[model samples]
Target chain A: MKKNIILASTSTVFGQPYLSYLKEELEILFADAKEIIFIPYARPGGISHDDYTAKAAAFFKEIRVAVKGLHNFDDPISALQNCQGIFTGGGNTFLLVKQLHELNILPTLRSVVDNGVPYLGTSAGSNLGGMTMQTTNDMPIVYPPSFETAGWVPFNLNPHYLDPIPGTTHMGETRETRIAEFHTQNSIPVVGLREGSWVRVTDHKIKLGGPLTARIFEQGKQPYELSPGASIEFA
Target chain B: MKKNIILASTSTVFGQPYLSYLKEELEILFADAKEIIFIPYARPGGISHDDYTAKAAAFFKEIRVAVKGLHNFDDPISALQNCQGIFTGGGNTFLLVKQLHELNILPTLRSVVDNGVPYLGTSAGSNLGGMTMQTTNDMPIVYPPSFETAGWVPFNLNPHYLDPIPGTTHMGETRETRIAEFHTQNSIPVVGLREGSWVRVTDHKIKLGGPLTARIFEQGKQPYELSPGASIEFA
Candidate 1:
């Protein structure tokens, strides 16, 4: 079965326009969908389940879509089993991954998507769909034990991308240098996404969204920038 | 020819008690020392060569010490090869490791110690003597091109350890839990050391120093705490 997956770069509720834009995109992708399964368990930033549910309810009202929070749904596998579409709201990617891993819902989540239930993720949500969660800016403030992450997408995504600070003389290396170091040790590709931007995946094809250009770092070759609307084949 | 290696946690200027303590420890370790070689290139926290040299000059006044920063020495390996003792001052461990890895000095440093050079490390300097640099709380504020680290000690050291916050309700796990998680995935043990505390190693025997207790985390076993002066065999 064919399904749509939306990966958002952030979980800030203040970004109403971005959420609206994503909702519009998902609506077009799942035109015949009658309900949207909102997974707010990824929000570990002290946001209550009621607040998340209400936010989703308000956003999807124009489509008259039924919004449901999965916090009380202890059985994530079963809850996600027959869902028409899955939308992952963002907060802390590491926290989300920790819960998913602890509950053993990661594999099941992948299976649900394989069974053709569309998946939508933002920020932390989008992070889960990547090969590894090492790229997120969230502090390892809390330890989930292992750095294991879902390997849905081929490359790691660096959300909230920014350039180097001018005239900073700290002994530590900069973010770009760190990412470059990661590329040196690992062969994984990294996608630096800016605000209001996302990666749209359908039927195994990945395309860029929004107006900013995404930076790609690979070994031996000079790092290149990909403008929005650019498409790349991931093997 | 037995040599001495002193690994200091911080690079101290003249008249600093910490620097004097380090020198005293080195003197005791190498009672017959004729010269002391200083490796100040390892100091990366905006510490200039002259600044470190001046610090060394003050210490050398009272004792028979010859300070030679690695950069000024004709052949670092040769200088270390025939030195009576090598003193490594600290600043940023990651930066130190990055430079050492780049110049391929780790293997030689290890060899020097294997040849009976009593090696000592403090703070970030002490971190380089561990198997992995994962435990260092230094911010990955800047990214180096690689995570390569000096693999001296069998376990990773978490220097400057702090307990969990009293009333904060951070969603993520605490530092202890995180270290445990690291053990689950990797077999390496993590030693959580607080300031003023250190682990003294001699011929593969590790002794806890200072007043703080060192916590050890391993897979499947409950985390254990070791008091100061507790000794463990580490290769």
Candidate 2:
């Protein structure tokens, strides 16, 4: 049997109501699983290991929860190697990538996922499953030496989709405009997920969630929208 | 006499009127200097060394312009050892920080400034001179191992400040709000500079620039605005 993997978008314990929904979904998805290894080290927002572990413990109290041993990257790798499922909580995507790259866990992560470890990601965690970490809103809290992402799920995921600012000529482009600019430079499709919306990948199929629509942009094409329950074939 | 430093906020040769102002300012500042060194290697937006050099050459045709000898961080340090002043162009701040940190030039750059070497930073270059590169709008194009910034300047500079977005429930914080958040966490004051506005720093004095008012925020106090020509004492 393939182990499960869950990647969450945000590390805020109770910020988004959808987190509970996601937790419930994972419980149903991995009902037969015996152990759940929660990895909260991805949060680099100054939260300590104990704090993150406690946060996970609070949420996963109903389940058999075991916070992943984070003495170092090797422990996370070993946990991945033997665990039934892995859950990655989100905080800052860049910070998480920096840690993953520093510890050289990105390659191992890919291997486990390819071996069919059911991976789950929320916000920043969901972002790691994509091709690039360019869409995150977190400040570049740290430099990670490289921008190469996990590339597990194809395309870029823009979490927390927002509209453009009015009447402000800010030097930097807005998130939406930035994504559009990315499409102009590259031919990759981008999925903009609003709050409470998510994408579920099972085997070879990708499904959308919540009432929000996923904005899709492809090169040389007009951007389109996808509603909840819509399944997009993984390309 | 201390060597002069020029920091710019953008590299768009055209389109932005501020570029011309930067050019004029550079001409006036470097007029008396025997030679001017162009540090185009800091343009990390995939701008080729040749192209960067050529752009600097085209801009300062009459003046003796020499591209800094250190193309990447691997070259000899002597390239910038005897320079009159250094001008850094703008691009993606994250990319610039990534390269500088990788080549280990950040500390050396800081040393040059400490030794009284004149420095000029535009856009991403300007962002580098500040205490942290958190305020930049550049997509996290690359991840370096840490978020440590080139603490050349004491405050965070928010170049190209803009107004808030309209009627959006999903409003993420504006640039000002984001900077305020940083101030809440760190005591450092954030200076919001619109295009064409820069802080001229010499020794201990910091002066504001044209038309736009700079928003200065400190912890435990309401944010205030600084009009152009207002001098701030940096301790």
Candidate 3:
């Protein structure tokens, strides 16, 4: 089976319903999938796993596909192993990564996706599809055992990437500055996936999707943009 | 010796010179001190330790206090143990925490501050004065050994705190929402210190300083505003 993945910057764009922006693309990506295993470890505002899962389920229902929360399974490892498709929703990356590591199924989840099961991720979920979660914009509300994530792609991701607001006085590190700091400590390339943008993978080929351009950061080099439909491979 | 400390939200406000806003307060805080030990580990924008220290030194020069970087001393523990005054400049909290833990000087730094060393922290430095660094608003560029900090105060500090913008398209977590998430995971109260604001601790009497009101977040409770010069007690 060939790999089919869509790692999006956000589940919902501003002034849009959740997952509506990607409706057409997802209809094709999950064409053959009978059901999607939803991992809701990252939902924010203190939303519970079941509640988060139900929210995803409600969205997928419009497409006539069933969605099941990974937590609902008696054996999550087995559920991942047998699931036809997977969809991880957006929330806190640290909390998601921590829960996945603690459940001792991070490797299983990674392996299943690597085996070519159709996968979809948004925001924090998209971060998990990268080589590591080091470039995540989420706060370290909880510390994960390791910063490692699924290495389905060669590079790391900076989801919900925003350009510096001009004439703004906010002193917090901008998304670009933060990614630059990550390069100082690690050599991994980072994809600053903007809202409505995503990285689509099919088999061995990977491409940037959506209308916007994706920002690319590498060690010792100026950041550049990868236009939509361009390959995401790094040197 | 009483705990005479100042944990500021930022070293420099938007339109002011670095450390100038706290000039009068700092002079009174370090009134009897000879020199101040400067921890430049948190300096941002890819600045070096020596350069960061020099910047801090120039600021303290007005007060006739010599600022020395902790990296310059062969024995940082000894230098910290005997320093009359201490100032940890702001930048990246994770980087500072990582360096302190790697050097195995975290305990010593905490001990010295707890023993009334007239400690001063700004931004990232202020985050370290809390019970833990989990509430920091910094990017985790590097993973530290632990989320622990100096615990100089009973609660954590969220420096450079900003309220939610009224008409923004950005979907990232607001400072208030992020602090609410922190409360879900931990019980420590978090003081959202706006830029130009600070927490002043004179022994057991802790107060919010500056003109702006500090936002306070406690577990399972609605966040509220704390007026300047108001007591910062959680209960």
Clashes of each: 22, 41, 0
Better model by DockQ: candidate 1 vs candidate 2: 2
lDDT of each: 0.64, 0.65, 0.90
TM-score of each: 0.55, 0.69, 0.98
Which 10 consecutive positions of candidate 1 chain A have the poorest summed lDDT? A138-147
RMSD of 1: 10.0
Query: What lDDT is reached at residue B142 by model 3?
Result: 84
Give the C-alpha miss distance for residue B29 in model 2, angstroms. Answer: 3.9
The per-residue C-alpha lDDT of model 2 at residue B226 equals 81
Model 3 Cα shift for residue B72 (angstroms):
1.0
In model 3, which residue pairs have backbone atoms overlapping below 3 Å? none
TM-score of 3: 0.98
Task: Give me the candidate number with maximum lDDT.
Answer: 3
**lDDT tens per residue, model 2, A1-235:** 2334443334333345435756677676557556656556555445666677667666666655444534334577776777666666766665678778888778887787768766667677788888888777766545566767777667778777665656655555566656655553466677887766777776666777665677786666677788778985434
Q: DockQ score for model 1, please?
A: 0.06
Candidate 1 wrong stretches, greater than 4 Å:
A1-3, A11-18, A169-172, B1-235
